[model samples]
Target: MPVYDQERAGGHPGRPLIQNQTVRIVVIYAIFGLAWIYGSDHIIDLLIDDKGMLLQIAVAKGFVFILCTATLLYILINRLLGQLAAADRGRLENLENLSQKNAQLRLFFESAPASLAMFDRDMRYMEVSRRWLSMYGLGERDIIGLSHYEVFPEIPEYWKECHRRGLAGETLREEAEEFRRADGSLQYVRWEIRPWYQAAGEVGGIVIFTEDITERKRFETALEANERFLRLLTDHLPGLVGYWNGDLTCGFANRPYRDWFGKNNDEIIGSTMRALLGEELFLQNEPHVRAVLAGEPQHFQRTLVKRDGETAYVWSHYIPDLVEGSVHGFYVLVSDVTELKRAETERQRLEHQLQQAQKMESVGRLAGGIAHDFNNLLTVIMGLAQLGMRELGAGHPTLVRLEGIQHAAEKSAALTSQLLGFARKQTIAPRALNLNGAVEEMLKMLKRLVGEDIDLAWNPGRDLWKVCMDPSQLDQILANLCVNARDAITDIGKITIETGNVSFDAEYCNAHFDFVPGEYVLLAVSDDGCGMDRETMAQIFEPFFSTKEIGRGTGLGLATVYGIVKQNNGFINTYSELGEGTTFKIYLPRHTEEGARPLPEAAPAPCHGGSETILLVEDEASILNVAVSLLTLQGYQVLPAAKPGDALELAQQHRDRIDLVITDVVMPDMNGRELVRRLLPFCPKVKCLYMSGYTANVIAHHGVLDQGVNFISKPFTMNDLAAKVRAVLDAKGEAVD
Candidate 1:
């Protein structure tokens, strides 16, 4: 039977011979027979009074003894059978009590929360809890009555040894066990085995208690993986990162932090913040650290100096780690923002430059518009005065006055030219020229302009590149820059003019932001004088903006230089420091073609009389009258008209051959080009010369004369008109000058 069997009832196994009811009854009857035989012989001897009745007495005695013995046997058998029946009833009650206790024990084992099972000494499954079966993913039928090895054939030898030790009355417990199930999945289990004892205190079987902790183990693994990934991410970041405990000691730091401080993790992990950051920085950041420790997040920007002696701008963030409403530690995050700050500053500077350029552009347009109209009025005044001087001659008293009037008008016209220069509207005559020779030629004039106290130095470049620009404009640029230098000097100062070749590549252009990538001729003018500050430099290009005191300057000098440079597709850069000096660098595009020879100065041809009829058109009354009168005095028959329609009528009525047609460029009735187009039908071969104060956009592109167009700028003398008219007539094809 099993050691812990529930079938054993309350009883002892050993028995005594005297306790047998049948044996005891047989002994009693034997004793009684012996005693009765003896007693009957004695009674017969004592009663011998009647010797004759002796045989009858003996037979009576035998009958009486038989009866007595039979009765005794009957009574003893009945009493013994009654006692045996009572004992059987008591044994039945005890068996029923044992059965109830067995049922209760089975219920307790099956209802346990933990997985439990019992195996006999033979290792066969004796009992299993519902939880044990469910935990092993098995039914009751699968494990009950089966041997431990048969049920879990893949169990490790170690576990089999544990079972053996348990059966030997030793208890075994394992906090963690890796059990590889039959389906190839691993299960984490915590289990214990102990020997179950019988009522006699002997070892019976082993009982196992197990708890599945697989989910908890999986959670731990995932948490570790996530921690490793986060560490990797923070280590590679460009910004410094660290964690600090409440005691102000660093608990962790990423790669950037280690590199910046020139320390490894071993040296830094437990170091105090004050030691790592130094005394100064630690004190500077103490308040923010305190705020974080008080459970408030802190953020600020500061400059951190590295171990290499370089400084970095950082945006620092400290986020407190809170646990159960108490401060634990803080996390540090830093971002390098040095480059971003620099870019923002550069953007603001460029925006300011753009605003200044736009302001100059608006002023230029306004000044150009006014100068154009001013030139027209000066043209009429100069023409009438010059025509009067020709008619009066040198002998007349009015001749001197008329010459003076013409001189004043000519000066006024020069002033208008300066205005147009500032406006970037002056007519340009571009041609290839060598810069070195040009600078050499201007040195004498520049010396005179700067005065004797100031010295002028000309450093001409060798084998300089030729540039396609107007020589007159080049002279203007040099003159303005020199004059500005002269004014800036308070005492003896030196002005240097230099010429050289420079090449700009894409990378340089990108850095400068406003330069074109090409080869250029550099013209730099430097002055050892009172230099300008940044505020003055920014406004220097604006029209009429001057640093000189009132009445000493017109303020158009540098403005004109800026306009001319831009008009010629060049750029200018200026560098200056207060009390140091100033230098202006001008870069003009280099022309690939060979330069042309400088034109020789031409003398004016003498005005002579012509007999051919002339048709002259002018919009201004005074200009038209003076032109007609001057041509008539020169022995040509003149036809004057103020409007294009009147000129057309005059052309039709004139039967004689018209030798020339001089017309004003801009008129209400029609432009000079259109007038010529219509009148050519009447005078097919007549030479035409178009004259204007300034050529408008309709007849010229950006103040440059159109190709094959015969044009002369206004405010001309009588000699100029005569020469231009004759030149137009002399040309075999279309005339440009």
Candidate 2:
């Protein structure tokens, strides 16, 4: 046994309680026995008279002494035995109570809801809760005396250090740390280790409390990862995204939103809207903000000036984040639509231009149709007048009246020509002519037309490019433009005519609705006159739309100019503000090849008679009768057919080869070109003359006579018809046959 245990057993050192009581009884007996012997001897010596009597008294005293000693020893031993029995009983009771308390304490440890364990100072397990046992996978087993390290040999050095500190009376705690168990499995553990004290106020052992928090930690980790992923997604989106609290404080902003504010997330989050947007912008957006906060979603287009001073058009959507009918905040989604807006505007403008062009086309068709019929009537009237005056010779009685009728018909014919010009059906021959030369040639005549009240200035550009257009059409354009300019000048105004070579690019043409990307010859006429307003300028090219008094102006002037420009595949632009000068810019495509064919000289003055067989085909009876008479007056064999089919029948039956076939271009049965084509099989030697007032859908293409095809306009005088016939007969180039 240990030395302390031996001392406690009363073997080596001082004894107290039961042992002291035994010693006290032994001393008392020794003192009493000694004193009894001494006292009895003395008493006998003093009281006895004879020696023999003294001996007898001593024997009695010895008996008495034996009796007294026996009695005293009995009393003392019994009392001591009784005291020892009581001490043994009290010790047994204490042992029994301690055992009960220990059992209760063990029960408490086993039944605890928490995971717990108690260990002695030597790190041996004293008790363990059921939870601890289950948690560590330790089943029902007597492990009360097992060493902590032995029970779970995989304990880390750090945990061992914690345990040592706990044994040293230092309490240690760790929450949610990794714990690798003996089975190579992992756990997140929250634990505290502390020293348990003994009743003597000394450190007894250590107790550990632990909880497995793996599931909770896993939940937290997943939540964090999901938040990070959402943030990444929002940041990469193209549209601006942001969130705001009910207090108008910014809570979240994606990458585009952050960039727009010129701030990072850290700086932007929690900032007030007023601060980020600035006072003016906030004020502008305040109503929208209020609406969104009231749970009303808003979608609108807005124009904003950015921080960098760039203008931006945005389509914005504000969606309210409502919770149970109460506004929590709002989400913003904005997309830039500046380019789309521009494209839309351009599309509308182009549509408007298209509508205007279509309207003009319709009007031109009406005018061309009118001119076609009028020219037919005028042709017969003028032809008959010429034949009448010619057959009667000079200075006859009815000659003056015939001349008056001829003159009226000629004037009416000129009016129809203007209509044809405006209708874009005027027969024209285009040649590559330089704009500078054309303008120079028109200077003298334009000056005479504009009058002395206005100065006509011609500024021809250096190295002016050539344009392809009819020379007569150019003259008409110049004369009409000059006349309009002269009328606009009430008192004294200057008209400036200019020519230049210009190049247009795609970008410029995109902005200019009427332009194309190419080089052009520009003919500009500017007049510092009583300029036109926008309303007047818009209708300036419409036929019969005149600003002048009824007697002073034929509205066809500018209309004809517009038609001629359009007919040559060109565009025209006019710039004028009321009371400021007016300028008309005509852009004709540049002629790329060679110099133009020189303008033809005037036609021969008088008629040249021909005795050739002539087939005159006309749709109108009056025109056919007059044309046949005119040809017969010129001493030609005339075969006149009012209808195209009749003309074809006439050709088949005719014996001699026909010299010339003059046919109306647009007839009911056939066109002049078709008639000529049919006649070619029989009269292979015949020459052809195609005549029409307006040949919009006939032998001419866009009113322009085909190459090598003889053509004449209607309302011709006898001389005019004779000259054209003589020219056709004298020409070296044969007909289509």
Q: RMSD to native for every prediction? A: 29.7, 28.4
TM-score each candidate.
Answer: 0.38, 0.35
Candidate 1 Cα outliers beyond 4 Å, as residue runs: 1-240, 250-288, 299-316, 334-359, 377-419, 431-434, 448-455, 461-468, 480-496, 500-562, 570-737
Candidate 1 lDDT: 0.79
Over 114-222, each residue of candidate 1 has an lDDT whose tens digit, in order, gives 6888888889998787888888878756677888888778788888889889989998998888988667899998899989887677887888889888998899889
- lDDT of candidates 1 onward, in order: 0.79, 0.79
Candidate 2 local lDDT, residue 48? 75
